[model samples]
Target chain A: MPIDLDEALKAIAHPVRRDMLSWLKDPQRHFPDQEHPLEIGVCAGQFDQRTGLSQSTVSAHLATLQRACLVTSRRVGQWNFFKRNQAAIDELVRRLGEEL
Target chain B: MPIDLDEALKAIAHPVRRDMLSWLKDPQRHFPDQEHPLEIGVCAGQFDQRTGLSQSTVSAHLATLQRACLVTSRRVGQWNFFKRNQAAIDELVRRLGEEL
Candidate 1:
């Protein structure tokens, strides 16, 4: 099936989500050091600090992005590490080339 | 200058605009014959027929896409012909590669 462009667009519509994508571009600059931060992705608390939004709101936004397949998460112990899904991103670009 | 991802995303967020881009993909299939349709792009009336939207509403949607740099227009006598701007589309993809 073709990717749902509507859902993808809606997922990235919010300013905070857009900021999250921007921050993920350079995680070291936007997020704090954690154990194997580059290999493991940034933690949700780091996202909250970078965005300056409430922890709950950031958590919800990350959930939205994860559901939309824009980002991927890995649960390690108590923290959920979030990273940009390059495959999904490339798929989006490919679909735009073919569909748009 | 880098393309504005937010504005481009907002422009394509609408169903009609997305339809327009999809139609423009295969103009001959979606649009009817006109004087040099391929060279001149599809006219507003043909777009209205294909989309089943009111002429005024389709016109307005086309204008919105034009403003957002997603589409470009050419005036031919009394009718307006609109086509997808490939450069802008390519730029959007490029920005997505760099930014997102």
Candidate 2:
């Protein structure tokens, strides 16, 4: 549990990642309309642009979120769509509330 | 707010730090009797023994927690006593729930 907590905390410890989570919370508002369905989630390019960072950097950040179970990703053709994992975040908050 | 979140998350991201929080949850059970009152909190030497870490290492970890406002410390003679700041932790968790 500590290891999982460590991973989740480290994944969320960064400013960019924290900002990304906030943006990802309401992708429809933060990002431009996509041709694909919104339910599929926001693509990496949108995050890349908003972050003002390299695509690789944004991708790495997304991967960290995925690893921490804070976000879920889905591949759509050449693009990967990412969305917040609300359940995981809620559970993390609950655990942290209890533990901390 | 992001900077505060960054500090709080980074302070708690380490396993040792997280373990310390759990132990501090109930200092009476986790630590031996203090020559002083328990209300003052656990001394650094007790943490040093439990962590199996050097006193300097334990102190550094405690300092990070204090900087993040997750823990409070008081100087008692030659020793610094430390304990969890429940209100700050609750506030951080609340903010994280809202932001994340």
Candidate 3:
């Protein structure tokens, strides 16, 4: 899917959302307690624990990032895993360089 | 002064503000019919005319961009000439590439 520049910009405006992206950049290092490998990305529960925020709050933030195409999420039975959408992020930076 | 990444991201989140930056990128092209040269950047009046927004509204938008360090303004007598802070913008893109 094509990245929505406006949405991406809005998504990263908040500190929590930005921190989420930063953490997801290196799941293995940030989320060491996860049983699943980094390939499936970090589970949502890990984010709740890492951020010390409520599950719903973390989920909402993740949803915002996912909406912006800054992150991608997958449902693994019960838990949802999320990883940085590096390509969309790269394109956003490139476009901002040229267009902004 | 250091660029505020969070502020810049917040500033550009709005479409009008983003369009303002895009317009200021090429002042001579985006804004014409001004008495002053490009050295002072585009006068705030031109923005009001181009955007068809009230002067106060335009000023508010410009203020938001200025606060973000995305754009800089100079008080040319009674009018404020605004221009893109290319260096800060470049730094922002570079940092986003690494940090975001």
| Residue-level lDDT for B35 in candidate 1 | 54
**How does the DockQ of candidate 1 come out?**
0.42
lDDT of model 2, residue A31: 88
Model 3 sits at an interface RMSD, in angstroms, of: 1.2
Most DockQ-accurate candidate: 2
In candidate 3, position B45 carries an lDDT of: 94
Indicate the residue-level lDDT of A84 in model 1: 91
Judging by DockQ, tell me the better candidate of 2 and 3.
2
Query: Which residue pairs show backbone clashes in model 2?
Result: none
CAPRI accuracy category, model 2: high
Alpha-carbon local distance difference test for all models = 0.79, 0.86, 0.88
Chain B TM-score of candidate number 3: 0.92
Between candidates 1 and 3, the one scoring higher on lDDT is 3
**Every model's TM-score:** 0.77, 0.89, 0.92
lDDT of residue B79 for candidate 1: 85
Candidate 3 lDDT, A1-71, residue by residue in tens: 77888899989888899899999888878998889988988899998999999999999999999999899
**DockQ-superior candidate, 1 or 3:** 3
List candidate 1 segments past 4 Å from native: A13-16, A25-29, A35-41, A74-79, B14-16, B25-29, B35-38, B75-78
CAPRI category for model 1: acceptable
Clash tally, candidates in order: 0, 0, 0
Clashes of 2: 0
Query: Which pairs of residues collide in model 1?
Result: none
